[model samples]
Target: MGSVFCEGLTHAAMYARFRPQVPASLVNYILSFLQEKCKGPMNNAIDVGCGSGQSTRVLSSHFKNVVGFDISEAQVAEANKLEKLANVSYKVNRAEKLPCETQSVQLVNAGQACHWFDLSKFFIEADRVLVPGGVIALYGYQFPMPIWENKTEKLTKLFTDLYLDSLHGYIKKESLDVYYSNYRNLRFRIPFEDYVQIRNETLYAEHQATVADFVGYISSWSSFQNFQTQHGQEAAYDILNTFETKFMNELGVNTSSADTELTLRTNYFLQLGRKPTTTTKRGNSPVEKQTNLTH
Candidate 1:
């Protein structure tokens, strides 16, 4: 149930500090679909693999009670430490075995962390906990593209090379394979109704951060952490230092400070499915609604 990537306290803290929060538009997109088949008011929503409660906290605004689950104790502890709404709580638990009662949860969501789960077991658990018409939303963002005033294209290429080329060897292929395929490689079975696939390749979860902050975000990547573990801090930091220097140079910021501010444009994808209602027929074929929404 545990992921090797997110283990220690330092990593968990860094994850909480740097990972982007779930965008409100994406949340609304999920909820809109959930509300369509939902019987009554939105009640319980669970955020599985909820690292540091960033995604979990957002659900508090819509649900009566929102619970976040993660396999890492350090992550749950860091989530608990954060100031969240009274209705939101974090627990150390695995995705395959949810703690909720049968037919109780309205929505079961997994953010960037879904790729690490045993999807077959987790789907069964999601089916067990969700109400007949409840929704299961699996969503994640791709590597962030750096956006400056006018040099957006060149900066994006630089960022892409940093992620896909420089850190390629460090990436855990098994989990990232699912992620890199945008979860399309995952096979779904019966009892789940229609499948809604949304790929917003340009939908930006706009985040304002300094060059140091961006480096912090990059360092939070599991691949980067792996690199740090194997190569040691000095060697690993050399990569970030090079990135910082190049990024600052592109922006013409000669202050030699890592505090140069920039915007991060992250693309998102969502795979949504619904549990069959009482009158709905259980079928092997899933109806798919695919959309490429640009924002």
Candidate 2:
């Protein structure tokens, strides 16, 4: 998890271009829960770890004001460049130290990016920033179930076994810890009363892509990028191409631009907690620490 944002323009650009939006159904699912439980105005939402503003932009349509925050200047810059919403803004801020007043936000969210935070610090900050009955949602999604047709699922299995699986060592161990428990079971300081467990859900996204898009999608992974940085780019992409070849050959195609429709059964793990209306010296209360890690 060192250099969580990862250096280089190419990495940031690839993330912005390839990371798919969290499926609308999932977004609506969260919004619906908040609307039902919130006791304050639905004025603003802070999208922490909102890399490339994909999740941030989604919130803008619902909340009157949406702000995206990330520690990377490059990520923040890229988000700003592609963003045009008048009420939406991007900031270079950490999840544990948001530049906001106490109880100023209606909702605080993390999209596939909370595993990186120091949980102790984050919970304190989340409590301090959210209004009474304000909701906090943390969620992450698994890799896509790459497919061209029914039988092609086997091709995806072969590809994962060969390429994606090889990058396991490059992935942050803390992320594995979170996944093993399912995102719902995170250790947090949110009091038991305010802890509202969201059911684990599997939402589907049927996306159209060329073979190159599929490759680019994998390239967006932090583990894949880390492998490229440590072991020359030529060596890393070579292995990727072999996996690509195996899939293309399965489909009886040889080009990277072949039209491929990928159906991703994204297993979304959502953990929701509400900020306590009665504060108990929130930030001063000591709690177990969380890893400053990321995907």
Best by lDDT: 1
Tell me the deviation in Å of residue 117 in model 2.
0.5
Q: Which stretches of candidate 2 lie over 4 Å from their true place?
A: 1-9, 188-194, 254-258, 277-295
Q: TM-score for all predictions?
A: 0.86, 0.86
How many backbone clashes can be found in candidate 1? 0
Task: Give Cα-based local distance difference scores for all models.
Answer: 0.76, 0.72
Q: Candidate 2: what lDDT? A: 0.72
Q: Model 1 off-target regions past 4 Å?
A: 1-9, 188-202, 279-295
RMSD for each model, in Å, please?
6.4, 5.1
Which lDDT tens digits does candidate 2 get at residues 237-267? Answer: 7766776676677777544444554554456
Question: lDDT at 57 for candidate 1?
Answer: 91
Error of 1 at 115 (Å): 0.7
Error of 1 at 236 (Å): 1.3
lDDT of 1: 0.76
